[model samples]
Every structure is written in structure tokens, then in C-alpha cells.
Target: MRSEPLRFFAWNLGLPLAIALAIFAVFDLTSLDEIISNWLYYPNHEFPFGHNRLFENLTHRWPRIIPDLTGEAAIIGSILSFIWPLMKPGKHDRLLRLLEALRIAPLLRFTARYRRDFLFIVVSFAVITGMIHFFKSHTSIYCPVETTLYGGTMEKKEWFENFSLFHEAGPGRCWPGGHASGGFTMVALYFVARRHQWRHARAILYASTLLGAIYGTTRVLQGWHFMSHTFWAGVIVWISALLTALAFYGWRRLASPAVQAPGSAPPAPEQALSGLG
Candidate 1:
């Protein structure tokens, strides 16, 4: 039997547990006085770049790369968001069926065919969860600095003062916006799944990219993360996806069997080989 303890743990707990534990460990190891001094009084030690300036530039600039569209463009984006999934019906439908089967159908079929894919999905979810937790913890810890630098005072927003809202608001975390990470990861997955030019490929890719960009912008606009944090979050996610893909699929593809030569007969079935000889 395959030992999938890590996969099982990720499936059940997700990445947040790991992140939360790590944060707790950090807090325990470092003194509260030191943490406060490093973050607020002497921000230079915690984050070298001025947080406010970095955010202002990105909030003003990054949107221009894709052009901030008005009425019709916005409607088009909304329409595409709804329509893209319908364009490629196979995988999503299969996933739904698998879920249904888990609830109502037999277990054997699900395990036989969908186990690996399910493991991949679970791992993806775990990674996203971990990214979200990490972002939230880091952002909440640094919000005072960010608010002071950008809003010009410590008493700027109620949201900044309340850490619980980070979980309540959802996706308010400072670093790698979960939406951005998940959206881009979906794009990468789509790129791998459909090597050909499928109907939904272009639409899904464009929509996901847009969603990621919007998420990054929202994080900056909402004062949760600075421009540099958002930018680096994106960098971290891209690197993670690249590394995961290379480790899992890329290596496997390289080791897979080559295609048979044209017009050549396939190898005889093992059951028939002994009789034939």
C-alpha cells in the first residue's frame, strides 16, 4: 500500500494548522517587547522598504498592465466568469460525479480511478490554506506598521485594529492573497491538463489571471498588505506552483513510456505470452 500520510494529513487539516503552529512557535521563541520594537518603533529592521510608498505605487500602477476597463468590459468579464466552466465540461463533471459517488455510489470505483487526482486536489487545497494562514498572520502582525505608514496614523481603520476580522472578512490576509494563489494555480493546472487549444482554455486562463490581479489590488486597496508584500506573495505562489509541478508531473512525464512506432503491433498480453511461446 502506498504510504500517503502527508497527503492524508493535508486532506484533513489543510495548511492552516501547520502555519498557525509555526506562528505560535515564533511568538513563543521571541519576546513580546522585541517583536513590538522590531515591527513598530524600528520598522527598518522588520521591513526595509517603506510599506506605504510601495503600496501606493502598485495600487496606482499594476492595473494599467491589463487596462482598467469600464462598463462593457466589466460586463464581459462577468459573463465570461459564468460561461467558462460550461465550455469545458469533462473534468468538472467527472469531479462532481466522483463526489456524488462518494456520497451515494460505490467506493471501489472512486478509489480505483480517482485516487491520485483526488490526492492532487487535496494537496492543492492544503497549499492554498497554508498560504492564506501565513498571509493572515503576517498581515495582522504588520498592520499597525502598514496603517501608520500609509494612513498616516495608528487610528485609521477599525479593521486594522481587530485581528479577528482577518478570518471573518476572508481573503484579507497580507501576503499572497488566497484568491490570487488559487486562481493562478488553477491556470497552471489548466495549462497542464489541456495541452491542446480547448475552447475554455483561453477564457479560463484570462479569467483566472484577472481574478488574481483583482485580488492583489484589493489587498493593497483595503490596507491589508503593502505593494511589496503583494508582489512577493505572487512571487512565492508562482515559485511554489512551479516547484510542485516540476516535482510531481514534470518528473513523471519524463519517466513515462515512449509511444510505439507507427504501424507496429502492440506487445502481447502477459496472459497470452506463455501460451503463444
Candidate 2:
């Protein structure tokens, strides 16, 4: 069978392939072992622990939840990608328009008009920063546990010898992955925007949740973070989502003047498309 040139090249050597090589090179040259050992074993000082045990326990369970969720998302995304082209042309166009509305321009404008959405972003940033500070202050407490769970007890020089294939860059430090938080935040926004459409809203909610879970799981498996970190990240994201929803709804009522009732379907596809033009 004939193959498209771009597809053939991408199949053989793509951006991911190049990135993988660069990562391997960095791993070989850096004294990652020494860094991990010093960070995990050598305690510089002591600090009060603030992390809740119950929360940590819940976070730890995140590792178990991610794989199943990720598998389902993968299956769904695959099906969507395959079937999208086979959809009616009009349906496909509508889908495209829906996605276009999600572009940065609209999102930014929406956030600008709504102080609450902006506030939510600020709060999420503050929360993330606070978590980082906590990690630094209580470094001695968490690092040891992180090392024992994710990093094996090996000499600095032999660290790579026992390295797991799943290990990704930034292991130990990149715990409570930002990626998972970002994914969940997107999910929340989708939920608020499409709440009236039961089936569609549920699909998006499930997909977004799956994405967040998968991202967190991958980080843990790669030894980039502990299960606890990912869990807290998800919690923070959920909080951010609630704030974002409030901001959006409040702003819509204030800015538009006309308070349209909730649960209204969006304009018809042709009307929406014409409005866009």
C-alpha cells in the first residue's frame, strides 16, 4: 500500500523520538543519583508536618485508580479519532465549531469579563505555590518516604543500574503532578459549560477525569511523583474548577445584563456558524 510522505516520516521518526534521545543523553550525563541521595537521605533541618494522614492515604490510592481510568480514556479517544471522520459532514462541522470556541481567545476573553474566573486562576496558582513551599519546608519528612517507595536504596553510582524503564525525568521532585491538575481543571470547565446536556456532559466529565487520572498514574509509574502528590494535585484542581464555574456564571449574568436562565441549549449549528462569520 502507498503511504503519505508526512505520515511515513512521522511514523518512522517524529518529535517524540527526538525528545526520547535528548532525555536519554541528559540522564547519562547528569549526576541524578547524587542529587536523589542527598535530597532523600541527608536531612538539613526539621519542620512541622502539615499533611493530613487521611488525605495522604487517599492520594496513595490514586496509583490504583489511574490505570483503569487511563485504559478507558485511551479506548474512547481512539474510537473518537476513528469515528470523527465518518460522522455526517454537518455534524463534523458542528464539532469543529464547538472546539474552535474553546480556543485561547474566547477563554481569555471570558475570563477577562469575569473577575471570578481570574480569581480562580490566581487561587489555583497560590495553592500550587503553597504546596511547593510545604514540600520545601518539610523536605526531610517526605523525601525519605519518597525515596523508599519510588527510588531504591542503591549507591549513587549504581542508581541507574536499578533504574526502572517506567522512570521519567523529574522523579521525586515532580510529585503531585501539575499535569493532572491542569487536566482536571479543564474537566471542570467543561462540566460547568455543558451541564444541561446530560449525555454530553457526562462523557466530557468522564473523559476529563480519565485524563487526569492517567496523567497522575503515568507520573507515579515513572517515579516522577508519589501517589500522594498526584492526589493532592487533583484535589486542588477540583477546588479551582468550582471557583471557575462560579466566576463564569456570575460574570455572564453581570456583563450580559440579560440574565438568561440556566440549562439553555446553545444556538443551532447553522446559526452558530453564521454568527461566527
Q: Which one wins on TM-score? A: 1
Clash count per candidate:
0, 2
Q: lDDT (0-100) at residue 22 of candidate 2? A: 54
Model 2 lDDT tens row, 188-240: 43424342333366577677667777666544443444444455555555545
Model 1 Cα RMSD, 1 decimal: 14.5
lDDT of 1 by residue, 189-215 (tens): 443343323446568656755656665
Instruction: Give TM per candidate.
Output: 0.39, 0.35
- Among all windows of ten consecutive residues in candidate 2, which has the lowest summed lDDT? 154-163
Off by over 4 Å in 2: 1-175, 195-199, 250-277
Candidate 2 has what TM-score? 0.35
User: On a 0 to 100 scale, what is the lDDT of residue 235 in model 1?
Assistant: 47
